[model samples]
Target: MTTVELQRDLPADPERVWRALTDPAELAAWYWPERMAPAVECDPVVGGAWRIASAPDGTAVGGRFLAVARPLSLSWTWRWDGEEHESVVAVTLAPTAPELDTPDGTRLHLLHDGLRPEDVGSHREGWVSCLDRLPAHLGADGSERA
Candidate 1:
């Protein structure tokens, strides 16, 4: 199995970043908006169940929250139907020290592991595209448009 990783530095606080990642309303502004359901439920706790279906109509976006560390980290199971594949997605938000290039912001790191090598590119593209929109979504004058 191979792993796909993506990292992005957003111009937002960890709390705001956390909201973008975990809050349903915020999620709709970016990540998979076309497929994000009304967030039937979210517990954000270890061993808690998490599920989000697609839009236009409901479609299973299989997964469950595995661990949570508030605005720091979250891990979950990931799988797409019509494919006998399962993987783990872990996201970590680390605050960057004050610097010329990087101010008080969080470095968002994401890893998708346990995927067959052939699936890496697709997953990589997905994450790359997703992260590309993140900064804009969280920017000073940004708004969710995904």
Candidate 2:
């Protein structure tokens, strides 16, 4: 199995980044731009389920929460529409140091494991696109959008 590992130092704080991950509205804002309007159901608790379905593309992504630690880390199972196997996604957030610049910033680390090697490229692109929009959705103050 292959793993897709990505680390991004975001302009927002850890709390704001956490909200973007678990909040339905915040997710809809940046998850998939292809979805004009997304139907999102997110329950950020252990054993909880989360799903996001898009309209035009008719694509859906879902999974169950395996672990949840608010404002810090979370892990879940991930399976996309028409996909047979499910991957494990683990995310960790930490505060950026004063030296790295962006004083009130967050270092977001995401790990998606259990993927076939053929699936890595697409998964990497998908995640990169989604994460690129996260900063904008985090808002200027970081908390307002939460």
Tell me, by lDDT, which candidate is best: 2
lDDT tens digits by residue: candidate 2, 78-102: 9997989999999999988867856
Q: Give model 2's TM-score versus the native structure.
A: 0.92
**Per-residue lDDT of 17-95 in model 1, one digit per residue for the tens?**
9988887666666776444444434557787766655655655555778889999999988877455677999999998
Q: Residue 63, candidate 2: how far off, in angstroms?
A: 0.4
RMSD of each: 3.8, 2.4
Error of 2 at 73 (Å): 0.4
Clashing pairs in 1: 35-54, 35-55
lDDT of 2: 0.87
Q: What is the lDDT of residue 42 in candidate 2?
A: 98
Collision pairs in model 2: none
TM-scores, one per candidate: 0.82, 0.92
Q: Best candidate, TM-score-wise?
A: 2
